[model samples]
Structures are given as structure tokens and as C-alpha cells.
Target: MTTFDNLLLDLDTASGILTITLNRPTKLNALNSATISDIHGAMQQALDDEQVRGIIMTGSGEKAFVAGADIAELAGLNEISGRRFAEQGQDAFALIEESTKPVIAAVNGFALGGGAELAMACHLRVASENARFGQPEVNLGLIPGYGGTQRLAQLVGKGKALEMMLTGDPIKADEALRLGLVNHVVPQAELLGFCQLLLMRILSKAPLAVGLVIDCVNAFYDPERHGYQTEANSFSRCCGSDDFREGTSAFLDKRPAAFTGN
Candidate 1:
């Protein structure tokens, strides 16, 4: 229930879903230092709350999920300050990528530049039919500073990422899906509802196992990280849990399992 100047937090305790909406519609919910700081805080709040099992991030207004970074703020950055700002945004986004609970980006409209980077940081992205995505930092004579270069390539392959970054052209929802940039494309009215249903389905499973799966899958992309080892370790950890016992017993009894996330 923390108050934020640039964001709105809605926690559905019964469903264990926390929806964080980016405010500042006048600028298309552009990223600034204040907004980035608020997002980091909001994510920490969700992680600390036992009632929060998942998160959905979107923009307040229908015009944009987030158009890009605040150009006014970026125009003032020098070399030293620009690196610092990029690092700060990266730290904030790393929280989203590494969270124990699932985070879904409900892209309701434009997700350009840093906005696109923010969506990429989430575990999954579900875009509305009207959503547009791009890494158009080149248009401003700069590059994507908030992990967009790396993540964009990772998500949509190097060739497509290079095409988008170099051209600074925006892609609509269908193109984004074809490029594997988004998980689902739904009507704008159905975006939030669809994300909530997906989260609830995830929450119905064992929480510990779910967290481990996220860790293992993310490790797959790290050069120094051994994904197989991580998977083995997580599997062994899950084997020792009480939920494992209940899940097996219920299967044998031909009944639905009631997992307590142990």
C-alpha cells in the first residue's frame, strides 16, 4: 500500500496478484529517475508480501504502456551521468527479472525504447492488439541503455533486434508476436483479465517449484551459469518439500492437489 508519486499499485490479495501501473500519461509514461525508483520499491513490496504471488505491469493511460525514457531528462545527461543513469535503471529491472514470483508485462500501447526494455525484463509479455514495440533510441542519436540491446537480441534473435535498433522503426502487436517478442496478443479490454487468469493458473501450482523453474530457465542464458546443474539442484530441493509429498499422494488417489507452497 505504499504511495508513489509516479505509479499506482493495486494488490489483489485474494488472487495474490499485484498490478503496478505506470502513471505520467502526459509523457506516455516515460521512464525517469523518480518513476524507476518507485518501480524498484513497488517490486520489493510485492516480493515481501506473502499474499503477492505474481505481478502485472502496465501503464495508466490507454495511449502507452511506456513510450520511452523521458527525453527531457536524457537530454541533460553527460557521459558520467548517462552511465550512472543506465546502471540505475538496469539495477531496478534486474529486480523484475530475478523476482521469485512471476511478472507479466501487459503492454496496452506503445512500448518504445526503455519501455520496451522494461517489458523485456518481465518473465512474460502479453500485448494488447493496439500495442507497438521498438528500440528507437537510434532516432535520438543514442542507443538503448536499459538492457534493451542485450535483451532484445535475446528475445527476438540478433538479426531482428539489429533491424529494429538500426532502423528505429516500430512494430505492431502481430509483428511482435511473430518475432517471439510477446507471449499473447489480446484485445485491449482483455489484456489485464488475460494476464490475471494466467497468473492464477501459475499460482495454482507449487510456489517453490515455480520459483526454481524461473531460476533455471534464466540461468540458461548466462555463459558462465550451468543450467543443468541449477535444474538438478532445484529438482532435488523440490523433492524434499512437503508439497512434493502431497502432489504425489493426490495423483495416486486420483484427486486434485492442494499445495501450500511448502
Candidate 2:
């Protein structure tokens, strides 16, 4: 549970869960160059760590999961580097969304602009009652550069998604839940506990099977419609993972089986 310069990657082997916390709480967990680099490094670390069965992403303080990208970082970039910024971010977000294991966003408070986009990049999201979500970049004479316009509409429908982006207005947790923007909402005090509980539930199932579900769903959006091909590959890959063997063995024995993200 060592802290990186810009982020905190905590591992709780007792629960087989890794929690990635966005630091810079004083900046409202704003994403800056160093912070983004730290995130990319941390996510890659999690993906390569075998003991980590599931993951939770959150912010350092109660005030925000991440309010937005750091304006300071954005201000100095030239057009070419700016384009690379979007590309790098897309790659990081894609890795989070496409990881073999489940990644959950435990959004505690404000999740705006790139913050909201970050949550969308996770496999799923659970929010605190105090959470506020929006893609207000449009208000700043900009639009969402990190998959917001696309993923938002995919989740809540084109009309609803457009309204939010067009007006730069935010939705609270209850409304987000109603609109299917978030999976669940609970009090801020219980946010981390609830995330742990959700992962515990996930841990009860077969890891390969869970990975298959995630892969299949994401495949549907793949441009090549190679989604089905992707699904087949994933299904086959899981068949050989150690967790699959343990799962079947446990079923036959009628006992809980251990998983190691194999």
C-alpha cells in the first residue's frame, strides 16, 4: 500500500481487492499530466498483479471522485500534444474498461467533465448520494474529448445524453440512478463499504465466467463486429485460466473455491 507521487494504489489481499485512489484531493482530484501518468502506471500494475481479483477506483477526499482535468495542464499544451493527450487518455480509459477483471468506480462526489468520462470508462459505477455527475465541458467552450459524448448517449439514450451536454447541467445521484447512468447509490459514509460488498459478491462467482460476461458485452460495440469473434476468443481464453479449473472443481465438491486471477 505504498503511495505514488500523484496517486495511491492500495491492495487489500484479505479481500482480494485493490483500491486505486486518485490523490491531489486539494485539487479536487483533478487530472493533471503527472496524475494521468500515475493512473496509467497504476492501472497497468493492477492488470499485471495476479492476487488482485477485483478493483475499486475512487478519489482521495469526500469532496470529489474527480471534478475534471487540470486546467493548468491543458493550458500549456499545443494542438499536436493536445491530440496526443486525448489519445493517451483514451488508451488509459480503454484499458480500464477492457480489463479482464471487473473495475468499479466508487464515485463519492463531483464527477464532471473528464471525471464523468472516467467513470464511464469503468466497467461499472456506484455512487454516493452526494455525487453529482455531468459533462459540462461544453460550457467552457469545449466538448467532451474523452469518450463522453459517445458513451453518455450509449448509456442513457441520445436525447437524454444530448440534453446534459448541451446545457452543461449536472444530475444528482438519484437522478443518475433513475436514468441508468449509475448502477447504485448509497450514503457517502457507506460508499467504500458498499463497493467492498459488491466485490465480495463478485468474488463468489467464477472469475472466468465473470470475465466472459464483461468481454461479451463490450464486444457488441467493437467496430469490426468482430465482437463475436472477440467473445469467442475470450470464452476460449477463460477456459484455460486457473480460476476456471478451480470453479468447476469447487462446484463438484460443493465448496467455495479460491481464485487467483489466473
Candidate 3:
């Protein structure tokens, strides 16, 4: 396990699930430079570990999953520096979005600005009934700089995404689900458990095929690649894997498939 100053990494050895908690309750788990760096480092560590099959991200306190980016840090940005700052955060989040292992955001409370962006980067989101989400950068005389503008529009429609960004207003958990921004909305206490169960269900499948599904889905939104071609290629690759053989053979034998992620 890797130690991080602004994040807590907990690995469930039996389930191979890694839960990463943002540890800045004082600032409502705000994304400061150090916190962003810690997130990048922790994600890298998880990606490299064979035992880590999935990830769950949440904040330390019940008050917030993450309120926003650290405004004090945002205040120092000039044009050139602002671009670089945006790029830095984007790169860290892109790592999350591109990971082969599924990542779920267990949003407990407020997820605003950069926090909202972080949640959107995950493969799935399970929000608590108390959760609130928004891209309120407009209130600070800025726009979402951490892939929020793009992902938000992709998740929700352009009209609703624009309404939220322009108004700088937050929406509750149920509204988020209706907008397709979250997968499930449960009681605050059930958020983590629900996410863990969801991940465990996904992890039970063939690992190689699971990863290919993520790749194929992402390729749908990527401009540089064709979605159908990517899916076809991934399917062909899976056909050659040992897991694929075991899966088919197990189905014929009418027993549970014990996948080794080959």
C-alpha cells in the first residue's frame, strides 16, 4: 500500500477492492495541488497492483465528497499558469478514466466544481441521498477546468449541462440520477457498501473481457478511434485469452467459472 498525505488508500485483500478517501475534511476535501498529486500517485499505485481489481473513491467526512477545488490555489492563476493548472488536473483525471479496472465514485455529499469533475471521471457513481452535484465555477468567475465541461455535457445532455454550469446551482441525488449523472442513490450509510457490491459483481466476470468493455466504451467517445473497430479488435483479442476458453468451457460444464484474469 502507498502512503499519501491527502488521501487514504484501503485495500480489501479478499475482494481486491481499493477504497480511496479524500482526507481534507477541513477544506471539504478540496482539490489542492498536493491533493491532486496524491490522487495521481494513488491511482498509479492501484493500476500497477495485480491484486487491485476495482476502486472506490469518496471523501472523509459526511458533509462532502469534495466541495470544490481549493479557491486559494485558483486565485493565483494567470493565463499561462491557468492552462497548465487545468492540464495538470485533466491529466490526473484522465488516468482515472482510462484505467482498465473499474472505478466507482461513492459520492456521499457535495460534489462541486473540480469535485464534480472527479466523480465524472469514474466508470460509475453511486450517490448518497444527501449528495449534491454541480459545476459552480461560474460563481468564481471561472469555468470547469478539469474536464468538467466535456464530461458533464457527455453524461447529461448539453442543455442541462449548460443550465447547471451557467446557473452555478447544485442538484440533489435523485435529480442527478435522472440526468444520468449517477448510477444509484441510496442512504448515506449505504453508499460505500452499495459501491463495493456493484464492483464485486463486475469483478466476478472475466477480467480481460471486463477491461475490454471499458476500452470499447471509451473508444466510442474518442475522436481518434472508431468505436466498432475497437470493439471488434477487443473481441478478437479476448477470443485468444485463456480466460475466454475457461469461461466457455465452464458454461458447457454448468459450473461457476473460476477466472484467473488470463
Candidate 4:
């Protein structure tokens, strides 16, 4: 319900999905500091809304999902300011990466630099046929500042990540898919719809289980954490939930399970 200068938030409570569009189409939906702040606020809003079980993020226009961070903003940063800027972006994106509700990037066009990092932060990415993705920060004499160096390597192999970052080259949607950077690549017109359908499919199941699944998977990448232990804990928690009982009973009764996310 909150208005933001950099983004548009549309929550479909009926579908339990929040669609957030980067609204600065004139600037190719770039991530300025204001826009990153808006995104963090919007993410918090979605997390607090029990009706929001999933989220879809995309750009407002056909030209881009996001071209990159605002160069003008980047151009003004000193060493101290630059470090703070990086941390701000990292914090904003950490929210997306850590969200219990699934977030899908519906990438319609250019997703470069910070934009690509934002997409990588999401649980999944569905790119349009015209979509382009890259980590071109090297061209600006910088490395990825928003967990892109980590997540990009995690999504694609380290070798591919290094190549892309080192070369400052962009890849088409199909290449992104081939590299496992994007889960699906569809026609531009169908990108949002496809992502929505995918979200609905995920939302139809037990919400608590979905959240725990996210937690368990994320633990795999944390050196200090053990994925197996996380999975065991999550499984035990799910077993104690009313939703799990309903799921089992519904199986016996041969009917669809209605979960309350308990």
C-alpha cells in the first residue's frame, strides 16, 4: 500500500503474490541508492504481510529489468562512501536472498551489473527471450559489490563467473539458461505470466515447508552451517505442524490438502 518513487508494489492477496516493478523505465530501471532503499522497504512490507506467500520482481518497460546501478551516484563516491554504498546494496539484496516467501525475477530485458546481482538474489529467475545478463562492473573499474561475486559463482560455476566478470560481456537469455543462471527463458509477453503460474504452483503447497526448504538450501552455502542439520531440524519442525497432519490426512482421504501455514 505504500508509494515509492523508484518502484511500484502490487499485492494480489487472492493469489498470495506481490509483484514489484522497478519503475524508472526512462533510466532503464537502474538501482540508485534511493531505489535500493525502496526495494528494502518493499521487501520488508511483503515479509510482514501474511497474505504475501510469494513475490515477482520485474521492470516497468520493455527495455530493461534493470540496466545497472545509477552511474551518476557511483561517480560521486569516495572510498568511505563507496564502501557504504556497497554495504547498503548488500543489505538490501540480503533481504531478498533470505526471504521465506519465494521471490522470482521476471527479467524482461537487460539485467547487468547490480541488476544481475539482484536477479541472482531471487529464489529463481525467468528471463524473457530478449533478456541480457552480465556482471560488467569491471568495465567501471569495480568488482560486483552486491554479493554478485558470491551468488554469481554459486549459480554458475566459478570459471564462468570469472569469465563473465573479467570480460565484462553480456549473455543472451538462452545462454543464461544454459549456464543455469536463469531457470527459464520465454517470450517477453509470457515472462510475467509464466513466473506467476510458477509461484501459484509453489504456493499451493505447505508454506512452512517451503520456507524451511529455503533455509536448508541456503545453509548449504554457509561455511559455518551444516545443511544436513538444517534439513533435519526443518523436517522435525514440519512434522510438528498442523499442515503436515492435514497433508497426511488429505492423502488418506483422497482430497486436496488445505494448509493454513501453521
**C-alpha-based local distance difference test score of model 3:** 0.96
Which of candidates 2 and 4 reaches a greater lDDT? Answer: 4
Q: How do the residues 200-223 of candidate 4 rate in per-residue lDDT, one tens digit apiece? A: 999999999999999899999989
Model 4 clashing residue pairs (backbone): none
Residue 149 CA error for candidate 2 (Å)?
A: 1.6
> What are the root-mean-square deviations of the candidates from the true structure over C-alphas?
0.8, 2.2, 0.7, 0.7
Residue-level lDDT of model 2, residues 82-165, one tens digit each, is 888887888788888889789999999999988999999998899999999999887667788878988999899999999999
What lDDT score is found at residue 176 in candidate 4?
A: 98
What overall lDDT, based on C-alpha atoms, would model 1 receive against the true structure? 0.95
| lDDT, each prediction | 0.95, 0.88, 0.96, 0.95
Q: Per-residue lDDT for 118 in model 3?
A: 98
Tell me each candidate's TM-score: 0.98, 0.91, 0.99, 0.99
Candidate 4 worst ten-residue window by lDDT:
44-53
Encode model 3's per-residue lDDT on 57-144: one tens digit a residue: 9999999999999999999999999998899899999999999999999998999999999999999999999999999999999999
Best by lDDT: 3
Regions more than 4 Å wrong, model 2:
1-3, 232-262
Off by over 4 Å in 1: none
What digit string (tens of lDDT, one per residue) describes model 1 on residues 39-158?
999998889989889999999888899999999999999999999999999999999998979999999999999999999999999999999999999999999998999999999999
Cα error, residue 56 of model 3, in Å, equals 0.4
Model 2: pairs clashing at backbone N, Cα or C within 3 Å: none
